[model samples]
Target chain A: MNEGETRKPIIVLVRPQLGENIGKAARAMLNFGLTEMRLVEPRDGWPNPSAGPAASGADIVLNRAQVYASTADAVADCAHVYATTVRKRGVTKPVVTPAEASSEIAAAQGRSAILFGPERSGLETEDVALARAILTVPINPEFGSLNLAQAVILCAYECSKHEGLVQPTQEDLLPPAPQEELDGLIAHLESMLEPKGYFRPEARAEATRRTLRGVLTKPAWNHLEVRTLRGVLSSLQREPRL
Target chain B: MNEGETRKPIIVLVRPQLGENIGKAARAMLNFGLTEMRLVEPRDGWPNPSAGPAASGADIVLNRAQVYASTADAVADCAHVYATTVRKRGVTKPVVTPAEASSEIAAAQGRSAILFGPERSGLETEDVALARAILTVPINPEFGSLNLAQAVILCAYECSKHEGLVQPTQEDLLPPAPQEELDGLIAHLESMLEPKGYFRPEARAEATRRTLRGVLTKPAWNHLEVRTLRGVLSSLQREPRL
Candidate 1:
């Protein structure tokens, strides 16, 4: 694996219940370039038949997943451990958002692991005690219902930002039209408006002109867009061909 | 709805296939405080029976969701429209990440809408043409397997960050123990270890002590933790009660 991949945090599901949820979690991890997965006493055990179909072709993550008997054994080699929890616990540990924890994991010296609890009950107090800090996703106060896979995807998504994932390119977007072309379009419209008595009230004409200029300038239309607008003005000026 | 809720971007599902996925998307949206959802020709039609069970108590979003006949009609009242797509398209619109799109939506005047296509096939070129910009989540190039709900959740999660969602409180954590308390705990451990020849070879004894000290100091144990460690050491020094 490359250096960036090595730095990626391992996703550990502590006592996860359903096989399908495990598969979904695997899909979520691989979506954002996280591959390593450790299962701490999964309820259905590993190599479940239901997992393959739910994984939706993310078998690599499931194939390489390691099963551990306990949470402590799962993160024995990790330098940093973060427990994912939604509700406020009475435990005394530093709580960090997924964004905060992801950045820290990216810069950490040794391997880091994020622990996710089971589908229904969430992490036991003893399980949470193993982590140095808590990772929480700030949700709506009235309604906070993030499923296991959803939580994993959010963390993986944030972590991908630090991995230097290539963003969608804007190369297709052309530069705005030159000043002369824009002036020409403005003049063409003014000429049409002049005969229609649009500027009849000369006292407020300058203000109206300024407002029109602001509306046109805000879009910063490229040459093609400018040409399209010019064609539109020409069509309006023409006698109905129909 | 409050000002922030009104300003929140509407999530438009275009020609969605499954009712379950639609319900899951609603749950995801509500988790991040997004209540507005618009459906454009769902395959099973509106009020699918499967939606309620899958929503998991996020009925508010589903109840208020508006149905439209076409993509254009769905975003007719919106001032800004963003299309969520995974693949690179030949379209020349500006492409942005969920983070960028959320921030823009948060600050934009008038209403904004984000369009998500069907479960199997993504946005048709014609559907995308109605949008002002394209929003794409940067994922693992080799393994892109984000489900419909997963995609909606990521966008909602990022948008929630701009909504001032309250972070998990760290009030439960106490400050690190005072220097004297830590020193006492270290000294107590050293006294026990000294008798066991743990600091062997006088020439390297200071280095060993420093390493020990470094290990203990890294955690920055609070006052209670230090006392607990001291108690453990004292207990170890005693004879086995059993």
Candidate 2:
């Protein structure tokens, strides 16, 4: 899909053993606005009461979650799937960070799922084989295991950041210069710098274009100031003697 | 190390179970420019033959690794230590993702290390007790085990990205305006707008400084041009026209 379409990640819980963990994962998913879920072999009943309270207000994930016996069934319609693991499991598939995976999932057609395994054993080695890439969390070597719900939260949070749900603290707040103004500024700069030999004969035009882009992209110049600068350049070009 | 000096992470493998995995971890660490490695209780001899072949030129990590017996001893001098795990080991510390962990680690003082565990049982519960915070990696629920070395690579990579290794994409590369030039510009701008009452007497100096800083920081004004503009302003300030 194009940038205009709203994108979300599908959280697939494979062989979840604890009802509370499932519920907690649901709650975490909702905390980041992720509701879609697919369940593969949940040991405890999906609608158990323990799950409801643990889910907080995330009943939506529980309500819409799809259940299956195998991971392949859950991700049948998914174009992209990532297997979560704390160990290598000897798979040769490409691995991606949660942020990268979210962007890929968002860009792909059809459904996508980030698969999770049981709390005790997690997914078997065979289960990870179905995924296109592996998702590994970076933790302390002394104690690297993470809670099931926590993993869900981590992925969900990364996906949310990638999807622009939260504004980054260091991002440039100013909007980029409009195309029309940028084009005019480029032309004006080229005309002025051309006579100054800023560009050699062979790569002159391309080099000039590159410099113009470099200057304008600095503060993302706005329309009025850009026009004023262009006017100054035009005047200079006309009155070469001055 | 203080905040400024703690931009990079010290990759630590605590009680690493396998030699090949250590090499693989080193390889991953190299991909992201992380060279430091601290080993806590390696099951196999470090700099093992198997590890070198597996490292694939991440020999820097292997060469620089410092080995210790206990996890606590390994990170004794570290101001911050994070344990990696797929499940919580009953530690009562804040849980943070590698991204968040890196930011905090970057701001912390003294050396830091992220601990990983042995292959079979992962990090011991006691080992996790020493960490100031717990790091959680987001993975697929169904396939949650990560290889020991892969874990090292992922965390190191994320930490490196925030430490200024990845330059900002903005194109302006002009030498920054000097402090004196910037000071002059601030003085000039304040005088230029003074007649219009842009800055009142009480807040004039502070407001002028802030505005100048904001504008100059945006485009990273050049030293020569800023002085020229300031010179023009000085002439205008001397005009004495109401």
A1-242 per-residue lDDT for model 2 (tens digits): 44323357689999898888888888778766677888898898566678887776678778888888787677755545688887665444455666667766655544567889899888876567556567876543333445687678767766755554442333333333444455566666555454454444655555334433544434444444455455444543442231
Best TM-score among the predictions, by candidate number: 1
Give Cα distance to truth, residue B115, candidate 1, Å.
1.2
Model 1 local distance difference test score:
0.83
In model 2 chain B, the worst 10-residue window by lDDT is B164-173
Q: So what's the TM-score on candidate 1?
A: 0.81
Over 4 Å off, model 2: A1-242, B1-6, B168-242
Mind giving the per-residue lDDT tens digits that candidate 2 earns over B117-138?
A: 8877887778888888889776
Which digits, one per residue and each the tens of the lDDT, describe model 1 over residues A86-151?
Answer: 987999999999999999999998999999999999999988999999999999999989999999
Model 1 chain A lDDT-worst window of ten: A233-242
Give the C-alpha miss distance for residue B242 in model 2, angstroms: 74
